[model samples]
Each structure stands twice: as structure tokens, then as C-alpha cells.
Target: MRRSRLGRFGSRLQSRSWPRFVPRFVPRFLRCLWPDTLFGRLVMILAIGMFAGQVLTSTIWFDTHESRTLEVPARLFASRLADTARLIALAPDDAARRALAQQLGDPKYQIAWIAAKAPGVDATSTAGFRREPIVQRVIGDLIRGVLARRLGAPPEIRLLEANVHDDSGKRGGILNLFDSPMPTGDFHVQLKLHGTGWSGWLDVRANEGQADALTEPHSLALDYLVRIYLIRFTAVCVLAFIAVRFAVQPLRQLAKAAEALGRNIHRPPLPVTGPSEVRSAAQSFNAMQQQLADSIAQRTRFLTAVSHDLRSPLTRLRLRAEMLPDPVWRERLRGDLDEMEAMVTSTLDAVQGIEITETRHEIDLDSMLEGLAQDLREAGHAVSIAGRAGRPVPGYPRNLKRCLQNLLDNAVRYGERADVQITDTGRSVRIVISDRGPGIADAALRERVFEPYVRLASKEGTGLGLTISRSIAAAHGGTLTLENRAERGLDAVLSLPRED
Candidate 1:
């Protein structure tokens, strides 16, 4: 039971047809993957190259600017602190000496100096120090160096010392005092002045101030770089797009011309424009179109001539056969002549059909199918119609009707019963014509069964029926297919593209 139901379902599926108006998205995908189109490849290349160039330029600019702006200033401040410490250690008198010690103890000094006359003189003592303001000024200068632009107020200061002894073993109270409590900022340098045996602890704040000076210049340079890059990139993109479009314009024309030629052999030549290469391609396409048109015209003329010439001979043959003495032989001869005449007419019709351009308009498919069924029924064929009524399909109504008539006629002749079904396949509309007859041979399934003068053995109809059907399908940008039903029949499917 399951097998039987499955067979029936398969039969129904085999009978289904497709629609004509399905979007060609798959072709676009193919173009992207293996970009045969000139415009596509050019745009892709331009985008990638621009991206790479921008990245390289930005990396080089950043590396060069970082070292110049940030690293050089810190080093210069450290060297200056060492030189300043040496200068202060060589001061001449005790008054000057005391002043230097006060300078060292001032909180504002970025580089501080300290001195001791004897071993026991307290490092923190302010005794006998009358020039405090001078000491404060010197300390302020050091603080300015330490903080640079960052200093909000002066910092606190501290002083420390170690005692020394002479050769007699009696110690000098305070031998030397060192500057301490370094002002902490971004950079700190400690310098120990040698000789004079008075180790001067120089705490130098090395905010060399170069970064503040360079900031505006570097920013301006970066801004200019960005603006230049943007302008260049925009210009390149626009130019590239235009150049690419111009380069590919001829190809686009060639493609359209080729398609038109295929659609209508007598299509006009493509316009010549753009560069020499583009003009050449356009010229070639035009030539090709002309050649194709000539070929088709020649073939059409030949078929017409042959068809006209054969008619007279066929008429004479019929006249001669009618004069035969035996009635049965005469009748048989007449029948044969009639069949020949029918075949000739069909052949001419099929040939002419190829030249017939599709006239697209919205056609009510359900009504068309119903009318076909009615006509077939009136002609005494057992035809059944089923399925939901669908929206109109955009196609040539006359050609579509003729194609359907052929399929229905064949179905009636072979199966002795015809069933027509319509379905909306979302992207397309499918028409399934099922005939309860012996199915087609599997060996010929993939063959071009719709070619002119080709017919299945089971189908007792004009050989051009399927060919005409397929031509009509192709004209409407659809397809016609024949398949064997899993049950006991053959199926003819006509698929028409939907607009939506």
C-alpha cells in the first residue's frame, strides 16, 4: 500500500512544470565566483588595491612620527640635569655655598644642591642663612624644569647628610649633605657630583618639554595626511569607477547585442563608442549579429522555397492517386497524401514559430486551462481539470495556447484520457498534463526530445508537437519537459516564469 501511494506521489511530481519569470540570481553568483565580466573584476581589484595602499601608508607615518615626538625630549632633559649639577658644585664662597644649600633644600627646584661646612652641621638647619629668597628662586627654576607644562604648584623639599673624619681621627661635625626628596613627575634623574668630596644629590625632573612643542605640528601633519588620503582615495575610486565603466561599456553593449541577436536574428547593430579596443569589440559583435541574421534569413528562405515547391508535387500526387481504379488503394493513397500534407503544414508552422517574437501580457492561467479542457471535451476527448486557480502569468497568450493544445492533443491520442493540473510554485507557475498511457523510455530521458522532427514512439501525433511546445516555452523564458509517471502514464510539464 505504501509503495503504491509513493508511486502515485512520484507520478504527480514528475508531471509538475516550472514558471518563466523566476529571477536569475544564480547567474549573478556565478559572475562573482568566476568573474568573467570585466566591470566586476575591475571594481574588485580597485577596492583591494586601495585598501592595501591605505594600510601601508598609515603604518609608515605612525612609526616615523612616534619616535620624533615622544622619545627625543626625554633624553635631552636627563643630559641637561647632569651638566647643571656640575656647575653648582664649583660655587666660590661660604655665603654662596650657603645659598646653594638653601637652593638644594627648596621644594620648587627640579635639580637640588646641598653643602656642609663641617661634619656636625645639621642638614635641616636654617642658621646663618640670610639669602632665603635667592635660594627660593633657584629652587623654582628646578621645579619648572621638573614639571614643565604639567606643574600646578611647587613641591616640598628635604635634605639629608653623612659626617666625615680628618686624618687626626677628630670628626668634622657635618662633612657633607646631599639633596634628597626628588620631585616626581613623568621622568626623574639623580646625579652625584664627583670631587670636592661634597656629593651633591641632584634630583632632576626630566620633562624636557619637547612633546608640548611638537604636539601641534604633529597633529597638523596627521590631519594633512588624513585629508590627503581621503581626497586621493575618493578621486581614485571615482576615476576607477568611471574608467572601469567605460572599459566595460563596450562589453555590456556586446552582451546585449548578442542576447538581442539570439532573441531576434534581425536585431540592429551595436553602437560604436569608447576606446579603440571597445570599438573593436563592438564592431565584432555587430558583425557577428549580421552574420547570424543572414544565416537565419537564408535558412528561412530555403524552408519557404522548399515548402512552396513541394506543394505542387504533393497536389499532383494526390490527383494521380485519386484516379486509381481500386477504391481501397485510392483511399489508402488519399490518407497517406493527407498525412503528408498535414506533416508539411506542421513543419512550416514550427519553422515560422521560431521567428515569432513573444508578446508578453498578464494571462489568466486558470481560465486558459479551463477553456482548453472545454475545447478538448467538445472534441470528444476525456479530459479532467483539477487544482487551485492561480494568478495571471506574464506571457504570449496565443503561443501558450497553441503549445497547450499540442500537449493536450498528444495526451488524448496516446492515453485516451487527459488530466490537467495547475500549481503555483512561488517563483513560477507549473502546468502538469498527465496521460494514463504507457510511459516513455528511460534511455531517451536526457535527450533533446523537444527537437524538431523528434517524437516518442508511444505518442501518435505530429513530430513537431514537443518541439513547438519547447520553442513556445523558450520564447516565454520558460521550459517544457516530458517525464514517465511512476504509475501507468506519461506526463508533459510546461513551466512558465512568474513576474513576482
Candidate 2:
């Protein structure tokens, strides 16, 4: 029970700590292993697939073709050497033996007599990544078996050069090619006669010049192996890259069109081309854009008409209130009439501001802010502007200026002072407008304050200022948000995306 409790406690502790530790560690490794872009990811996948395919192909080829081709020559050479030893031993004299040796010498196997002891055998040196010692061992075993059957005992044998050797008559460790059209080498052996002092060296090579279908050594050539893999892998990689690029082109165009539409709702619809899926997406996007434009137009016209129709009655009511006999009643009616008129005007202005048709241009926001600050200071408000955007942003000059003006007005009215700062992040610009004032008590009410006509108890505006300002910022592919400062006051942050 105690162990179980301990285990449970440990698990609970680990679970609590998991989030903090895993986020920092896992993402670094994931970033290193994973490709960042679509193109890179596709290429990486293709490379891995190609490598696996090559590995499988090499395994199959070596198992079936290479092993069979090399083994046949070793077996045949062993048999021939055994036959020659038998014939030389059967010959009556030296002259007769010499003649028999000459007769037995064929294009594939050559016999030469040598008077010396058998050379030392180094088994380990005979086999490696590039050398096959098993081939020589099999051949030696076959020769010894044949001699044992004929002579009643195995003859003394030494492997002078049982493995593949270059044209220079030396064992060329690895990656050495014999001078020929196809990679060729000699399989040689030297053995001593039982009673005679003479030792015979039997030289067996892979069939003269033309490698037969069964005995071809072309597969073993270093150049042939390298060229086949290099050329094949390179071609596969290029083809895979082209195929993947073509497949993702439609998606790239769709993303670009979406970004552009965000900047300007009036931008042209995407071209409905390419594959069936892409065409369907483009058609849907076009329909949605059309619907949104129609809805905005209809809403704008409704607001304009409502504002116009309400003005006549509001004017009449104001005039009638002024003529009232009771002083208190007359003043109260006049104030109500004035408030109604202000609401109508504010609504009309907000609607008009959002439906701006100003052309986009590269404007230096830093200069504009400085000029606006100077104007505000001239109007007897304390305004301080700090920090400047490094690059000009693409936007409507009039609408953007109006948006900034509303924010500055709000700051001065509520906080009594405006502090503005701008930061450029290459792709976007952030403008922070802060004021030292009584901030919103409820954090939830901060977002609700942007709603039209929803003024705070202490504020006296139509409350459409923030609503219109945010709309303008959004129309230019940006955002406007408000946050309560830790000390006192509210911070209004505006982010505008820069045109590349």
C-alpha cells in the first residue's frame, strides 16, 4: 500500500511537471529532425524512400546474381586444377610431363612448373568487405577432395593467389580493378608433387576477355556500381521534387488570394482553374466574397437611410423642447434631444468611416504620428510620441489617420495624457497608444467597450470610436486591441501588416 501510494504521488508530480519540461525539450529535437517547408519535406521523404529502395536492390542482386556468378568460376577452376595434377602425376618422365602440361594449358587455365616450397597461408587477409575468402576456401576444398580420391591422400597445397588479383600480379586489397573491359582477375594456386621436387602453379582466370552470361564481373566494377546509383538516385530526386511542386502550386495560389482578400475585400476573386478540388475551392471563395460585399453594402445603405430619416424628427423635437414653459422640464427635454442627435451623428460617422474607398499607398507612419502629435499639442493636450517605424506601411492614409485620431482623443479624454510608441517587425508594424487614466474595472468589459453606443459610466462619447477604429485596422489586414495597464490606465495596441 505504501509503495502504491508513493508511485501514485510520483506520477502526479511528473504529470504536473510534464508540460513545462516537454515543451522546451521536444520542440528543439522535432525542429532539427523535421523539414520546415513543404518542398523540403517532400524532398526528404523522397530521399529516404530512394535510399531504402537502393538498399533492398543491392541486397537482392548480391544474393542472387553476384554470388552465383563468382562461385561458378571458383568451382570450375578447382576441378581443372585437380585434373591437371592427376595427369602430370600419371606421366612417365620429365619430357612427357612437360608435353602433357603444355597440352593441358587452356585459355581459361594455364599450368607452369615451379621448384619451391608451398607459400604461407593467411586466412584472414583473404576475406574482407571487398574480398571473398569463402570463394578461395571452396575451391581449395574441391581441389583437395579430387586429389584425395585419386591419389589415396590429399596432396600438399598452398594458395599462392586464390583470390582476385590485378594485372600487376599482386593482390590489390580492395577497389583494385584488373585492366580489362570488364573487371577481371586471376585465381591461382601452387601445389607440390608427392615424390618429385617440382611444384606446379595452376593459373585460372575468369574466361579470357569476353565475360559469358554466367561469369560476368561487370557488376563488381567500382565505377559501374558508383555510376548506376549516383545517376539513378539523382534522377529520382529531381523527378520527385518537380512532381511535388506541381501538386502544391494550387494551394499556394489559394493562400495568396486569401491574404489579399483580407487586405482589400474589393480585390478580384481567385481564378477557378487547376484540378477539380482546387477549382471547387476557388468557386466557393468567390461566392463567399460576393456575399460579404453585398451584406456590407446593404448594411451601410440601411444605416445611412435610418440616420437621414431620424434627423427631421430630432430637429423638430429639439425646437419644441426649447419652447416648453417649465424651466426644469425644458432643460431636461433639450438635453435628451441633444443626446439623441449626437447618437445619430456618431452612428453615421462610424458607418461612413468603415466603408472607406481611399486608395492604398506607401505612407511613412512615423511622420504622420509626429504631425498628429504636434497638432494635438497645439490643441493644449499633453501628447508624447516615442519610437518610429523603420519602413513605410501600405494602407489608406485617410482611414488610418482617422483611426489614430480616435484613439488619441479617447486617451486624452479619459487619461489626460497620451503616450504613443511604434515598432516595426519587417513584416508588420505595431503601434501602442497608452494613457494614464482610470482603466476598466472588469477585464471582460474591455472588449465590450468597442461596441457602438456602449459607453462606460465615466465616459461621455457615443462609444463608436473604438468600433470604427478597429474596423479600419482590420480592413488593412491588421488588428486593434485594448488592455488594462498593471498600474493605471488602458493600453491600445494596433498591429498593421506590411506589404512585402
Which one is best on TM-score?
Answer: 2
lDDT of 1: 0.62
Each model's Cα RMSD = 17.0, 11.8
Instruction: Score candidate 1 by TM-score against the native.
Output: 0.56
| Structural similarity to truth (TM-score) of each candidate | 0.56, 0.59
Off by over 4 Å in 1: 1-40, 55-287, 441-448, 456-459
* Model 1 lDDT tens row, 1-500: 99999999778667744322222443443433534556756876786588668867765554333333323443354345434544565776444644664565423235544444446544445453333232233333443455333323332323121112122333212111011111111334344443544543444443333423322434554565567676777777788889889777767777766654554555556778778888888888878877776777788889889889999999999999989999999999999998888888888888777664454578888888889899889989999988854678877788788888888988898888899888887678888999988777674652566766766665455778788888778876788888888888888988887851
Model 2, which residues run further than 4 Å from truth? 1-231, 271-280, 424-428, 451-453, 483-488
lDDT of 1 at 184: 17
Q: Residue 157 deviation, candidate 1, in Å?
A: 39
Cα distance off (Å), candidate 1, residue 311: 1.2
**TM-score computed on alpha carbons, candidate 2:** 0.59
